[model samples]
Target: MALAYDDTNIFARILRGEIPCDKVAENDHALAFRDINPQAPVHVLVIPKGAYVSLDDFAANASDAEILSFTRLCAQVCTSEGVHLAGGHDGFRAIANAGPHGVQEVPHYHLHILGGRVMGPMLARKA
Candidate 1:
């Protein structure tokens, strides 16, 4: 299936400078910023500069440079936010929601880095 990217999405606007974001870290291929409606003490969103709709799309379509830069930026944010396991702080959770089942709010490919406290179960068990 062809991935549809909506340039008018909030992340796109932020990338285009049409909107402002509380930037945490940035590189040539990715931008990490604090989530406006944070779910945790350290809730940040990292988005690629490219136009991709979801994590699968990004993994399949993004260039090596884009992938590397984006991954590195995520690590950078974790360490800087004092949530990286290597930093001797509590670990972090990296989440990428996709499609309707995932309840993705934005149509752009973005990774959410959440930490600074226990995250509880990965997901509530469904009967």
Candidate 2:
């Protein structure tokens, strides 16, 4: 595989406005959009603005501000998606795909926030 992911690639295109997406939320550091093929009722992908191969790449290059933004965005998406929080009414899950073997289709760093209804156990615990 390439040393690093190319932004001009698919997910990056979506992030750059080269292609349209069901954008949920965005800031100077990150972007959130609905998953085209959602596994759960609410499946939003929160990705960084810059190009990074995967979660590892993001961790390596992300600044303190970027890291904070990513965490805040994740919480925001959970709220927007109605995921149970301190006083939230619904439930949600935050998922990040790491590498090829981990089922990462997109090369960009993103977190999939899924919710809207009760879901079964996580992949490891799924029947």
Candidate 3:
């Protein structure tokens, strides 16, 4: 089932211009901006202009154009941030945290781009 879209979410507010954001890049279908509470040296949040609660919701409910545009915008963000180097070892990580288990703070689906330095593993080892 498709999740209800929450317009009150911060991302929704940002997209609607109800809230201000430090925009980094924008395309016809998506917006890229710096994270207020960054977890990495280079942290950016990319989200589709469309309303979707989670990645699953986005994948199932969003249009093909929106899907393509969102993914393309993500690649653009990595490139623009200078973390994704071509023909080199330099690379970046794009993450989409979903639901409570994934620690998704916002109800809206978004991608986090992190790089510019060596990153640790996605999870810590169990002691």
Q: lDDT: which candidate is best? A: 1
**Between prediction 2 and prediction 3, which has the larger lDDT?**
3
Model 1 clash tally? 0
Worst 10 residues of 3 by lDDT: 1-10
TM-score for predicted model 2 compared with the true structure: 0.87
lDDT string for model 1 (2-82, tens) is 447889999999999999999999999999999999999999999999998999999998999999999999999999999
Candidate 3, superposed: residue stretches over 4 Å from native: 1-3, 87-89
Using all chains and alpha carbons, the TM-scores for the candidates as numbered come to 0.96, 0.87, 0.92
Candidate 1 residue runs with Cα over 4 Å from true position: 1-3
- Tens-place lDDT digits, model 2, residues 1-127: 5446876777889876789999898887888999999988899999988777777788888898898888788888887777857684766777888776778887778888888877787767556
Candidate 3 TM-score, C-alpha based: 0.92
* TM-score of decoy 1: 0.96
- Please tell me which predicted candidate would have the highest TM-score against the true structure: 1
Question: How close to the true structure is residue 44 of candidate 3, measured as C-alpha lDDT?
Answer: 98
- lDDT (Cα, tens digit) per residue for candidate 3, span 1-127: 3446778999999988999999999999999999999988899999999888889988988999999999999888888888887757488788998887888888899999999888879789999
